[model samples]
Target chain A: MTVAVDIKNRLGDFSLEARFESAGRLTALFGPSGSGKTSLVNLIGGLLRPDQGRIAAEGRVFVDTQAGVFVPKHKRRIGYVFQEPRLFPHLNVRSNLSYGRWFTPKGERHDDMGRVVELLGIGHLLDRRPSHLSGGEKQRVAIGRALLASPRLLLMDEPLAALDDARKAEIMPYIERLRDETKTPIVYVTHSIAEVARLASDVVVMAGGKVAAHGPTAEIMQRLDLLSEEEIGEGGSVVDMTVSAHDESFGMSVLHSAAGEVRVSGLGTPVGASVRVRIRARDVIIATERPRGLSALNILSGKIASISSGNGTLADVLIDCSGQIILARITRQSCHALALEPGKPVFAVVKTVSFDRANTMSGVKPG
Target chain B: MEWLDLSPEEWNAVRLSIKVATWAMVASLPPGLLIALLLARGKFWGKSIVNGIVHLPLILPPVVTGYLLLLTFGRRGPAGAFLAEHFGIVFSFRWTGAALACAIMGFPLMVRAIRLSIEAVDRRLEAAAGTLGANPIWVFLTITLPLTLPGVIAGMILSFAKAMGEFGATITFVSNIPGETQTLPSAIYTFTQVPGGDAGALRLTLVSIVISMAALIASEALSRRLGRRMDLE
Candidate 1:
C-alpha cells in the first residue's frame, strides 16, 4: 500500500467523507469537478486539515484525529504540484527545481538533478526564468522541483489543466517516464477520463464528495453499474494489447489483444509495444451474427454474459470475448428487437479504435 | 558643474540632510517590514487600532505630529527620561531628534507600501513551499521576502525622500540649529528669513531639488531593474 486515507470534513453546505486505499504507483482520484477530488488530495498533502479521521502514507501516520495528533504540511514531506505551476518567479529554472531540496534533510535528499533535467527534457531551460518559460515548460519544472525534494508521496492537482492539446501531448511522455523512473507513489486528480484511462493503474471514482467506487483501473472502467453515462462515454472497456503491425500508408496500427487483433487509426509505438485501448460502450454495435461488407474495421465474437439497462433509452450489454470482458451500449428497442439475453452468442462491432497516447498506444484502438 | 555651486554652510546642510534621511530610512525598515507582515497576515484584536496608530503621523499635521512625539519622548517624558537616564541617549534638541521625527512622519508611507506588496503575494506559493518541507520562517524568507523586494525598496526610498524634505516636524522637535539639527529644508527656511539671504536660499533650494530628483530617479530605476529581474510588475 502506498497511501491510505479516511477523513471527514465539512465546508458550509458541502460535506466530504471519503475512505480509500491506493496500491498502485500511479493512483488517480477520478471525478467530476466539486466531487472533492482536489480536497481529498489536499488533505493527503496536508494543505487542509481533516475534522476527523486518520491519514497515512507508507505506514507513517499524517493525521489521527482520535489521538489528537495533527502534522503540519511542512513536516508531511509530500510534494504538491498545483493546477498553476506556482514557480518562484525570482528564481531561474535550476533554482526552482532545487528550491525544495534546500529544505529536505540531507539524508532524505534525492540529488539526481542531472537525471531529473534529462527526464523532463529541460536541459536548455535551466538558465531561463519562469516568466520566460511556456505554460507546459513551467509545469515540467514544477514537477521536477517536487521530485527533487524526495517526497514520500506526490500529489498532482490537475497539473495539466492549463496546457493546450499540443502541450499536453508534449508532456504526457515525460510523466510516464517519471512514473517508470521514480519509486515514489503519485496521487493524480483529474476529471478527464482519457487521462485516467491512460495514466492510472487504480481509479477512485468520486461523486458529490463521496467515493462512489474504487478498484483496479480495468475493473472500475468496466463496471457499468458503478459509472454514469458521462463517465462511460467511449471508455467502457480498456483493452491491454501490444503493437503487432503498422501501416504507414493508411496511418494505422494493429494491436494484438486477448479478445482479438484490433486495428486503429494511429500506432505511435514500435512493434511489440503495449498500449491501452479505450472502447466506449456507445461505440460498440451488437450483431446476432457476423456481417459482411460492413465499414466497421474490427469485430469480436463473444457470449452475452449480462444485460443491464436501468433506463429504457440506454442499456449495457456485457460480452465475454474469449477470457476478456467488453461492453456494448445499445438502446432498449434494438436490445428487444435483437432479443438479446445472457448466454446468447453475439458479435461486438467496434466502429473505430481509440488509443491512449502513451507507450502502449494501439493504432487507433477505439477512443 | 557650475550649477553645483554651494558655500560651506550649504554643503553642511546638504550632508546633514543625507545623514538624517539615511538614519530615518535605516531605523524604520525592520519595524516597517514587521508591521507590514502583521497587517497582511495577522488576525488579532485591535488590529484596526494598530493600523490607525501607524498611519496617524501621515494624516496629522507635521507640527502636531512633532508635538505628540515631544509629549511622549521629551526629556521630561516617560520614554525620554528613562532612555536618557539608563542609556545616556537624548532625543530632544539634537540631530538624532530630527532623525527620530522624520522617521515617525515617514513610517506610514513605508508600511503602506510594504503591506500592499505583501498582500499582493500569492499565499498559494507559500503553501506550495510548505508542502516541499519548507517551514514557515523559511517560506517567509525565501518566498515572501524576495517576492516583496520591490515593495520594500519602494517603501525605503519613499521614507528616505520624505525624511530629506521634512521641515516642520524637524524644526519643531529639534529647532533649526546650524551644524546640528539644520538639515537642507531647515537651512533653506533659515536662509529665506533674513536680509541679503536670497543667494544662500537659492543655492540650498537648487541643491534640495537636485537631491530629491536624483533620489526619485534612482529609486525608479532600481525598482524597475529589480522588477525586471524578478518578473514582477
Candidate 2:
C-alpha cells in the first residue's frame, strides 16, 4: 500500500506545507521538535483538515480539497497510537480491545485477536485494567488495540517518547514485528534518529516545516549532503550483517557484512544469525596504507568515492568498499597529509571495541 | 408512629412531590447533557453568552426566575402559546408547570456537574477512539458518556434533590394548588400558614431533609462505585 500526501495548512503564523509518498511498510517522519512532524501525521490521519491538498492511501481518497471531499477520521480507517496509551479507562483491557471491533463493520474485520495478543505478548494482561499495567504494557496494549481495529494505516506519534530507555527497548521489538508482519502501512513519527534507523524502512526528513528529503533508509542515512551539516557530523550508515563464525581462541565473533567479514568483540549470537550494526563516520579512520602494529581489528581496503566539505574545519569522506558504503569524517589537515582523493586506495580502520554494542541487534535474519 | 400517620392531604403532597421531581429530572437530563457537552467541548461564537444564558436561573433569585418563566411560558407567551396550539399542551396552572419551574431552577446545577466532568475527560482519548473507527456519536455514547457517568449521576441526583425542595419558583409559576401544583415544600409552606398546622409543617420539613440526605448519600455511593470500576482510585 502507498500513502501520498501533499497538504498545506496554516495554524496562526506557522505554516505547514509538505509533500511526500511512501510505499515502505514503515515510513518515519523524522525531525526535531517544532518541525511539524506531528502536524503532518495528523493531516494524514484526518485529525487535522488542511487548507488545500490531496491525500490518498491504498488508492482510496481520504482528503481531496479540490473536490471538496473530506472523509472523517473514523471512516479513514487509520489507527492512531499516541504517546499516552489513551485506553478507555472505564473499560477493562478486554473491552478496550473489543471497542474497535464494535465499530468495525462485520465483513471488514480481518485481524485475528489471538495472534495479535500473542504478537504483542499481552495475553496474560487481557483481563487487567489499564491502571494496573506498567507504562510499557499499556503501550503494547494500545498497539494491539489499534491493530485489532483492522485499519488501513497506523500512525504512531512518538510512542516511545514517554517511556524510559528500558521501556523503549522493550517495545521496539514488538513494533518491529508489527512492521514486518502487518500489511497495513504505518507512519511512525519521532525525533530520535536511532529509532528511525532501527524501525523505518523509509525515512522522510523534515526541517522548518518542509520535506527536506525522502528515500530508502540506508540511502538517506548515507547522504551527507542532503542531511543537515550538524546531523552529518554525527550521523552514519547502518549495515545488516550476520555472525559467520565465532572464534573462542580470539575472543571475537566474525560478522559478515556486504563489504567483507568484520571481526567484532561479541559472542551472543550463533552462526548465521543476522545482526544490524551502526558505524558512525566520526568513529572511522582512514590510512593511506596498511599500518602494522595497530590495535584496531578492522581494516578494509577501499577507494574514496567522494569528499564533502562541512561547515567547520572537517570533511566527510565517502569510501566505497566493494558494493557497501562507509563514511569517515576527518580534518582537512588529515586529508591534505594523507592525500585522500576519489579513486585513492586506502584502508578504512575501525577499532573492534569501538563498535557500539548498544545500538547493535542480533538474531534477526536478513530478509 | 404519629409522624407516620399522614393525612390524605399530606399523602397527596408527598406523591405529587415525587411525580414532579421525577418528571423534572427526566425532562431536563437530555437538554442538560447537551448543554454541558456544548459548553464543555464546543468552540463557537458567543459561547460565553450561551454559557451565561444557561446559568442565569442559578444566579437569579428563585422568585424572579419563576416570574420570568411565568411570563415566557404563560398561556399567551410565544413558546407556551405555540405548544398549546400545536400539541394541546398546557404548562401554566398545572402539575407539568410545577415540573417546568423545578427543572429550570435545577438546570444549572445539573449542567455544571456534567460540564466539569466532561471537561475533565481527556480529549485525546476521544480522538483515539475516533481513529479506531468510531464515529462522533458512537464515541460519545461508548466513551465520553460512560467515562463521565459519575458526573451524570451526580448531576441527576443534585437536580432531583433541588427539584424536590423547589419552593419559590414552583409557587410563583404554577401556584400552590393542593393536589395539582403543590409539592412538598409548597405544601409545608401552606401548612405553616395556619395556627394549628405547625405539627404537619414540622413533619414535612423532616421528610424533606431525609429525602435530600438520602439522595446525597446515594450519589456519593454510586460515584464511588463507578470510580472504583473505572480504576480512578
Candidate 1 Cα misplacement greater than 4 A, ranges: A224-231, A245-252, A358-367, B1-5
Q: For residues A1-367, write the lDDT of model 1, one tens digit per residue.
A: 8989999999789899999998897899988899999999999998889999999998899999999988999998898999999999888999999989888899988648998888788899999999999999999999999999989888999998889998888877777766656888899999888888888889999999999999888888887666555666746888788889998999988888899988887755788877878888888999999989999989999999999888558888899999788888889889999999999999999986666564443222211
* 10 residues in a row with least lDDT, candidate 2 chain A: A352-361
Per model, the share of native interface contacts recovered reads: 0.86, 0.88
Q: What is the lDDT of residue B129 in candidate 1?
A: 90
Q: What is the per-residue lDDT of model 2 for residues B1-233, given as tens digits with 9 covering 90 to 100?
A: 77657889998998999999999999999999999999999999999999999899888999998888888888988889989999999999999999999998899999999999999988889999999999999999998999999999999998999999999988999899999999999999998898989889988888888888988898899999999989851
What is the TM-score of each candidate's chain B when compared with the real chain B? 0.96, 0.96
Evaluated at residue A349, the lDDT of candidate 2 is 90
TM-score of each: 0.95, 0.94
- lDDT, each prediction: 0.88, 0.87
- The lowest-lDDT stretch of 10 consecutive residues in candidate 2 chain B is B1-10
DockQ of 1: 0.71
